[model samples]
Target: MLQHQDHLALRLALIANKRATVVRLRDERRIDDTVLRRLQATLDSEEVRLSGGAAVE
Candidate 1:
């Protein structure tokens, strides 16, 4: 269970990093609004799952 919790934390951190990178890319015009929205939604969903106490795969 502790390992599972650690995995979840790591997943959250990775998702957050990816989200930040996407935002930076979008700001620099490397990615469009559509991609940004999609990425944001994915990140939000993962966050919801973690916050809801769902186990990480």
Candidate 2:
């Protein structure tokens, strides 16, 4: 399991990725729930692996 600090770090990493993706995609002026959900799911999977299956609130 990931320590609390590690979990926090993972969350921060995911947030950074999301923000970067948003900025990169913003010029398209198009976004959908499916896209956002996919991004979130990808992050969640990473977090689960990084945290040893335990997710932080």
Candidate 3:
């Protein structure tokens, strides 16, 4: 159970990091709005999936 929690935490952290990175890239104009939106949606799905089909925010 603890290990599962640890893995979940790690995955959440990674998703968060990816989100921040994506936003940063968008702000820097390295990624276009369409790509940003698509990636963000994908990340959102991943986060919700990790949270057992519920969104965190």
Model 1: per-residue Cα lDDT over 2-52, one tens digit each: 999999889889988998999999999999999999989888888878878
Q: Model 2, residue 22: what's the lDDT?
A: 65
| Ranking 2 against 3 by lDDT, winner | 3
Candidate 3 — which pairs collide? none
Tens digits of per-residue lDDT for model 3, 1-57? 999999999999999999999999999999999999999999999999999997597
lDDT for residue 17 in candidate 2, whole number 0-100:
81
Alpha-carbon runs more than 4 Å astray in model 1: 53-57
* lDDT of predicted model 2: 0.69
Local lDDT at 45 for model 1: 86
Better of 1 and 3 by lDDT: 3
How many Å off is the CA of 10 in candidate 2?
A: 6.0
Per-model TM against the reference: 0.79, 0.51, 0.94
Alpha-carbon shift of residue 31 in model 2 (angstroms) = 1.4
RMSD of 3: 0.7
lDDT of 2 by residue, 1-57 (tens): 468888778676877688568656654657666676777677667667766787555
Which parts of model 2 are misplaced by more than 4 Å?
1-29
Q: Model 2 — TM-score against the truth?
A: 0.51
Model 3 is weakest, by summed lDDT over 10 consecutive residues, at 48-57
C-alpha-based local distance difference test score of model 1:
0.88
